[model samples]
Target: MTEPMFWMSVAGVVLAYAGYPAYLVLRRSLDPWPVVPRAWTPPVDVLLVVHNAGDALEAKVANLQRLDYPAQRLTVHVVCDGCTDATAAVARRLASGRVRATVFAERRGKSACIGDLLPTLTGDVVLFVDVRQTLAPHALRALTAALADPSVGAASGELVIRDPTGFAAGVDAYWRYEKAIRRLESATGSMVGATGALYAARRQLIGPVPPGLILDDMWIPLSVADAGYRIVAVDDAIAVDHAPPDPAAEERRKRRTLSGNYQLLHRLPRLALPGAHPLSLRLWGHKWSRLLVPWLLATALASSALLAAAGSRLYLTLFLLQAGAYALAILGRRSAWLAGRFPPARVAAAFLSLNASAALALGDYLRNPRAHLWQTTRYQESGR
Candidate 1:
């Protein structure tokens, strides 16, 4: 084959294997699993790990207190690791008798704090939550009910981005697509991964997370799946939260996530095991492929540009289209005129943004594979 044809063929193969597989996995919502009767009154322990959380602590505690589940059956554990602010005091004052506070004067990582609290958990089910998010009133019940399935090792709630405006609007749109894909993957079998904002699993199925682990959420569910348990996502169980409004703040978050992806790729063997479930395969394709997408995209762009210089109009046209799409996406951020007029172009821009973020993340990963700890960015929530 000619050089231009060869490059196009390579791009086609990569898109088919990586991109098309994701499309198929995310094409449809999973059929609803039979609603299992709540036969067992298992004690539930909700673990909220906070670090220098500001005024949000009170709101989070209040939301938990208002859960529809019986208060007597639910216990909340707030782990304040290395919290310098009034986080511990706030937890103690607000929760009072309703919540238990585990304060570590020294700053161990979040995973280590979880490790310290793991042995102390006496509940049948352990639910993990972040400080900034709140679950729906019936979220606990729905998650617990889903976990009643013998094959399900863990269950995560649907994550809804509460506000979508400005830069966060794009992020919100992306999350909706992500939720749809997870729903489809779950229907086909097990979802690839759960959002850390809210998810629950049998206490016995959780293994001790490594102290250095940055993405405890990913590791916990993967561990459950490795032990032959299915990690399921329940649509009825919903958690609402917002993404960071600032693009730089969002970039920091993605960098940490990508770093964790690298760690998981190196550490998690169950993902590559032969005879792994279809769900596991789907998860592998969905998550890891995205991590490597930026690299692939870079190669495609460079090769296409080179082929275009060598007099291939097809390659040149595709390259120009890609560039124009990104320009329109930037324009979309400025005003509705561009966005409304070019919906397809905006979508392409969104995809390009995702690939760009992934590329930056891969660069960070390459520079320092050992870097794990990260300071959570403080960003304003857009009202839009």
Candidate 2:
């Protein structure tokens, strides 16, 4: 029983991390669905969502104004979601013919805020963005061009992290791996999700996201897929962001993101079943499988330990390798120097940290699905 459990767990881990991506690569090679992006300019609404981003609003608005797309075609909407700081005032001060500013008096989660603003959006394509990341001048152009393809419902921009070190370096590596998967998925079919920092969707396909929901990026793209359109990856569309200053900040971000995955699963149960969602297999491989990886790792480790106790040489070797990897992860966490010097250690630590975040996010999802609704108000005040 233990042997079967050990092998099953190992297979699951491989299937989640390696096997799925390999399948995508082969699929893309066999039957590639290419997006035909051209120099097409449509009216675009740049939706800049913020929560207590007073200091950053002005610069962000300036960044939007500087985009390579025609100023006349691009209209910037800065929505401040129940900001307690001078974010509202800054947005108002920056308001111009091209830049529109709206503020919510009460704190609402990002998804609710975006959903409420959907009806008011004025553009052929709605570009969603966060305050912190700056778009490359051509990013908007690239996304809009992809939208020019009638079959493509949405276009996701690639996120580029600048000057990462420590665990952030590992995060950067992971992001690259993730983007590769998205590219392959786009080539074969619609990707399961979009990069939340920067993505564009056709207004016609855009629908209201559930209130108090997290992972609007995933929801919007998947919803578009449900409407029989593809979400294409625009590698040229680049959104630039900085790594979190510290591990704690990264952890918080990861926890919130992983919890959003759970929220997505709960809201869209059809995605998990065969013949329900068009991209069900892709979602299972890319999104759902990773959610179970943490437990799979534990099962593999525990079973390996039990087999090793029974004097099995193969299981003993496997157990020692797993234990060594985790020990290195601990060392990487305790010593930033080691992680910085050794790339594998950094990756190991980041992998462990992410799995831990997944476990914690499960708790968060179970404890209070709406815990994030007022989270912005509380945490922003606390300087998170």
Candidate 3:
């Protein structure tokens, strides 16, 4: 085994999980861009696109109504895309001067819904919220307020898992860690992207939404940065949802998202490494590096095995440690009791599942597939 290959593989793993996070912390520590939240609540319009979401449509509408923003200032548009169920009915029941419902006879997917909705939005700020989460009363206000800073074209709210007692707790913790990185990245210059669960963008800045499976969150934020604007993360603006009871549903959701990342990177070539994309540094270390991790992991294992066979005692120990971590992952899945008792095991397992999902996502990207239309991963788990 070449020593350089072995070291590079090790470095790749380090850079993705540890090095990048460390860099974010250090960068934020050295130069903090303070974002003072303002009371200037611009007119916020919510465009909610749904496909076969009849079960939770009423609850979603209720959540929208409950947000702390002014009744006159907040408008909700629910677009039911080919939903054969009571999705349209629920939306119609809740429709009023403040709430409106749009129905499409055929399913063209989320991208199509977004494309149709963008032109109709007249508010100063347009918020895109997924049907799966309920926004905290202040989510709309905080996200919209951030746009008061002219440099920030878009802002994403923090998605918080409302409950955390089972296997899902590890998943919730994982997101918390991710939010931390986003906060630092936003402070430094621009966050690599926004969360679709709850996020807002200046109406003038939003152009045509890309058609197909590309992630709107990443594309919109990156496009904003490309147009000389920044995307900030609004931590206090929280959107709450139930984490999946198990990793199965979460894996499917991640597969779609990670694949979209792969597809978006290709669609927007400027975001790739060695390109002039202003967010290239953050994208490379934070985003592309994650896409490459499964391969790096395989290389690390093989290289370590070869080195061990060649009598390198240190490599042998490293290989054993890797093997043990995988063992813990297996245990985490097979025994919930053990996982609950030892949280570290569950976190390690979730990490493995995430990377495995990324590998599946790469395959999905290669197949040149269309995005799934409005299938919330944990919809069933949430019992909505």
Candidate 4:
């Protein structure tokens, strides 16, 4: 029983990180389901929900105005969510024939703002974007092109974070790894979640997002999948955002995102049930299993430690490896020397940080119901 428990614990951790991606690779190679994107430019509603992003709006709006799509077919809607800053004024000042602005007096979360604004958008496709990131000139066109495939109901653009250093480098490494997984997931079938920084969905396929939802990106894509549509990844559609300047800022952002994973399941329990969701298995393997990894790590450590105490050489070696990795992670957190010198250490440290955040996420969610009202993480604006 003890040996079985130890093996199971190790297997769970391995399967979540290594095994799942391997399965995805094999699945794509054997019975591949590819997205057939074509040249299609439907009417697009470019939506921006800003809180206190007034300083960035001018550049963002200018960037939108430069998109390689038909000006007549593209409209930009900027919703100001109770901005105490100059956000409302800037938005109103930017209003033009193709750009419109709306202001809400109350400080509703982004999800709530999106919900209120979604119904009013009348376009073939709605592209959701953040103010901080600058999209490629052809981003909207690339995103809409994926919607040319009948099975694809939503398309998520890739986010490129530039010039990362220190622990930000580790976070950046993790982001690249995550993007590869999403790309694979898209090629095989649907993405478990979409990139919130830049993603577009068919207007008819999406419904109003629930208020106070932290992960509207996840909710939106999963909802489209529930309606029997594929959520694709558009590699050519890029939104460039700079890496957070501070390691703590990156950790906070990660914690909030991890917390949202819990909130997602609570809000949409049907997604976990096989009978209710078509992509339940994928969701479990990709998202839910990851949530359990911290606990699995804890279990593996405890079980192996116990077995090692009983003089088992195999368990002792496993325990040493785990301990050394964590020690390196701790060292990596304090100083960037090891990770800067060793790329693998950078990723490992980042992976450990993520799992730690996932473990803490539940506490954050339970203690603060208003955790959805996010404080924006600071990052420099990236060009092109």
Ranked candidates (TM-score, high to low)? 4, 2, 3, 1
lDDT score, residue 240, model 1?
80
| lDDT (0 to 1) per candidate | 0.73, 0.87, 0.82, 0.88
The residue-by-residue lDDT of candidate 2 on 1-384, one tens digit each, is 999999999999999999999998888888989999889999999888788878777878888899998899999988888888898999999999999998899887888888888898778999999777878999999999899998999999999988888878887888889999999999987898999889999998976676787788899998899899999999999988877666677877888888988887787788899889888988899988999999999999999999999999999999999999999997886677988899999899889988989889999889877755634321222221
Error of 4 at 352 (Å): 1.1
Worst 10 residues of 4 by lDDT: 375-384
Badly placed stretches (over 4 Å) of model 3 are: 379-384
Kindly give the number of clashing pairs for every candidate: 1, 0, 0, 0
TM-scores of all candidate predictions against the true structure? 0.87, 0.96, 0.95, 0.96
Among these predictions, the greatest lDDT belongs to 4
Worst 10 residues of 2 by lDDT: 375-384
Q: Write model 3 residue lDDT over 1-384, tens digit each, in one string.
A: 466788999898898988988988888889877665677777878899887777877888898899888999889999888887788888788889999999998977787788888888889988988887888988887887788887889999988887565457677778878888898888887898998888898888876786675588887777788788889999889988876766787787888889988888778767886658888988987888999999899898888888889999999998898899889987886677877889988788778888888888988778857664546444444432
Writing each residue's lDDT as its tens digit, candidate 1 over 1-384 gives 346554665565476345644565545433444434354557899898888885678788788888888889899998887888888898777665558888889876778888889889999999898877777998998888888888888888988876555556666667777777666656655666788889998999898787867788888887787777877778888888775665556657877786777777667655655466444556556776576666655666677777789998998987787567667767765554554465654455456666677777766777764455556555453111
Alpha-carbon runs more than 4 Å astray in model 4: 381-384
Q: Write the per-residue lDDT of candidate 4 for residues 206-325, one digit (tens) a residue.
A: 966889999989888888998999999999999988877666777888889989988888887887887788788888888899998899899889989999999999999999999999
Give the clashing pairs for model 1. Answer: 30-187
Q: Is candidate 3 or candidate 4 better by lDDT?
A: 4
